[model samples]
Target: MSLTDQLMTDMKVAMKGHDKVGLSVIRMLKSALMNKKIEVGHDLTTTEEQQVVVSQMKQQKDSLVEFQNGHRDDLVAQTKEQMAVLDKYMPQQLSESAIRQLVQQTATDIGAESKADFGKLMKAVMAKTKSQADGSVVNQIVKEVLS
Candidate 1:
């Protein structure tokens, strides 16, 4: 099933099971996806749908950090639950070792030997990994590999 269909199915199950957190997260995801479709004025491809989920996950990560830093334990727990819900929609993430390997291989393929080639290396690795790898982790690995 497409992401939307999956969300719809999950939404109904959440409602029936009285899963408030899951229902809220699914509704938020549906809203984001709908907004993206309206913005593009066309049906979203599978890649586009994944991008939306990744974007949502990124926001949740940022919120999670802020909540932790602010010592809001209650909010932190809630955010973590939201993130858990979002996780179900994401593609399997790349391990750090896998990302490092990809960075090395891509750097070799692109002949990126110096830090100056950081942009090129990063673009290539991210293109290959798509939404599977976190950009910050990839960035750190790219810098380590290039330097």
Candidate 2:
């Protein structure tokens, strides 16, 4: 099923089960998807949908960290739950070692030799990795390999 269809199905189930957090997260995701569609004036492709989910997951993780830092356990828990819901839609993330290896290999493959070539290397790496790896991790790996 498409992510939207799966989300609709889960939302219905949540409604039937009176699952507050589940329902809320589904609604938030749906809203984000719809907004993307509106913003682009076109339906999202499979890749676009995945990108949206990844972006939302990243935002949720950031929020969770801020909440924890502020001593807002309730918000932190809520954000964590939302992240869990979103993660169901994302592919399993690559491990740190795997990401590092991919970054090094990509830089090598593209003949990226220094910090000046980082932009080129990053473009190639992101094209290959997409949502499977975090950008921050990829950047660190690229920097390490180049240095």
Q: In lDDT terms, how accurate is model 1?
A: 0.96
Worst 10 residues of 1 by lDDT: 85-94
What local distance difference test score does each model get? Answer: 0.96, 0.88
Lowest summed lDDT across 10 adjacent residues in model 2 is found at 84-93
TM-score of 2: 0.91
Q: Which residue pairs in model 1 clash with each other?
A: none
Q: Estimate each model's TM-score.
A: 0.96, 0.91
Best by TM-score: 1
Which residue pairs in model 2 clash with each other?
none
**Residue-level lDDT tens digits of model 2 in 77-130:** 888888887788886788999988888888778898989998999889889987
Q: Which stretches of candidate 1 lie over 4 Å from their true place?
A: none
Candidate 2: stretches off by over 4 Å: none
